[model samples]
Target: NATFGMGAISITSEREKDVDFTLGVMTTGVNLLISKPKIMDSIFQFMEPFSLNLWMAIVGASVGVSILYFVLDYPSEERKFSARETWWFSVGTLLMRGTDFAPRPSSQRILTAGFLFFVLITVSSYTANMAAFLTTNNLEKQIQSLEELVERSDFQCGTVKDSATMNFFKTSSKPIYRKVWSKMSEGGLVSGSKEGRERVRAGGYAFIFDYMINSYSELTSCETKMVGTPFRLQEHGIAMKQGASIKSILNINLLKIKESPIMTQLQTKWWENKRKCDFIESQPTVEFGIKHMAGVFIVGAGGLVCAILFFLSKKWFVAVRTKEKSAESDTGLEETLYTTDKTMSKEDIANAVKV
Candidate 1:
């Protein structure tokens, strides 16, 4: 027969020894944990006597509470504590933990509500994180966008062990998106070729299907332009733990955020704010010098030169037209005068012959 009584004693004794060891190092370990955040050291310190003792105490208390609630002669678990008892117990716990000083009735209510809210939020957040991981991992080859990936060269291209894009000069009816991650990890394989952009910029990686779109955008110093059609218009959403009601609240808020024109405007503003010169990149001085003042000067000077030539051409054209009009008028006058003289001479000759 298993000795339940001895089992309890053995467990308590073991826990007591652990507590003593933990407490022995608590002072030093606490200092180091606070200052350095060394995980190994912290673990060692956590094994100290006092720390172990505290842990044991917490476990023992929890176990005792569970036993009392379940095994004791109580109508229900709800009957274990009255409203005031529950409230005061919560307040005392919070105070002892240095979370709250003195808890008023209203404050207790608020804290209770807040605690519930936080629990919901935490559950939802975890769920969302899990969902994201699953979605991203399940993709055969994941890349945020082609435009984003093509901008850099350091980003690794990954694909399945055998794929079409991996085979150079292979013809295919469908467009192939290259994988970046797998290629980098594979031994004795190299991605060939560099483009004009990479030649100009250092640290540019030609990643195939890496989903680090933001990183690519940063490297390219361009608008976060995505390639091809957007697969989906996705909004960042909160996922919740299974059976958590907080997910609904988050979804509602997300919808409101999506519907708000402010959000669109904010995004536009952000993209605009993120704008960088393709030619100059992060070199603000160069870009500013070129675009702001020097460019204007060059354009102005060119316009001035064009204007001068245009004005001179206009003047020359007007002068040529005036000369042509004057010549035509003078020729017409000369012809009229000659015609009159010829007519007068013919009449005189006729008269003379008749006489």
Candidate 2:
């Protein structure tokens, strides 16, 4: 008696008496595997990772923060840091190559810290996600689901010949299954899983197979990925003669192995790891919008408004002080002129009385 290799022996109710199967080693389901699309050619495609609003917000932030920095630490009537130097500092922080223009006051230093934090997070996210966008292909149409597979007429799908997966479609009462079986009966059958996937790679075709094998192919070398949710959930077990004496012992051992870390080790060796590929995949990427980064923009806008208020308040105080100085000088000059007039009148009166 022989147990199946890997996860090939699917446990079925009909074979329970004749074949004494061990507890399932693994579970898998049916799914379709398709090739990754080639990269599409387009203009300004590199900027796709972040939405247009996000890009504009980033630009606005750079300018706003620079202006805020200039207003905060700048001398009222002289130059501590030039506007040109402040701008370079802003750009340098984003480029991750900070300049020598450091802020002097608490407010200016806090502005620098907030901006540096924003730049650190934003730039890291951009560089990390940029690869996915750069390698993107314009896939305007894709059969992402089984219902889509049924509806689309442009391509045909196939499976291994007389396999349990095919039998399932044949026996299923659902119209979609019946229709799929009908299409397969005509010309969609292949001799084995490998040939089925080969037909998939030849283009204008899709292959439905057990998810475990196809999933491994997707990770490693096939440039293939599973589309849609898996169906026909089933377990693969070790098959043996119905009354084999070692069945109970074997079942016990299998359970022990499943309960231990050995199961995880095997899965990691075979499935969890990905082999290096020449091209990186573009999928599973995030498209950053204003919402994802709203906090950064809000903080920057608030800083700009605060800086403007500070500037206006400084101007008002300076104007008030200048008015006070001018008023005191005018008062002193008026008093001196009045005293001179009084002295001249007294001298004239004395001269008249003496005559």
**Candidate whose lDDT is highest:** 2
TM-score of each: 0.23, 0.50
The TM-score leader among the candidates is 2
Q: Which stretches of candidate 1 lie above 4 Å from their native place? A: 1-204, 208-235, 278-355
Across 1-355, the per-residue lDDT of candidate 1 in tens digits comes to 2211110011123243322111110010000000111112234432322233434433443334323223221233224444444444443442334232333333233334433333343334434544544333232232345434434353433322232223321232334222323333443123322221232133223322222233234334442222233221222222223444554555566567666787668655654456563422121010111222333334433543443454456567768999999878766665665566775554454444345
lDDT of 1: 0.34
Model 2 per-residue lDDT tens digits across residues 1-355:
2643334767877667677787888888989987765444558767877989899888888887787777776564443667887788888887889886576665566677668778877887787668756555333467887677777777788888878888888888998888887777778899998887777777667788898888877777545667888889999987777677777887799889988999888888877766445445444345788888888767755655655665667677878989998777665655655576665554454454344
Clashes within 3 Å, all models in order: 30, 0
For candidate 2, the per-residue lDDT at 352 reads 41
Find the 10 residues in a row with the least total lDDT in model 2.
276-285
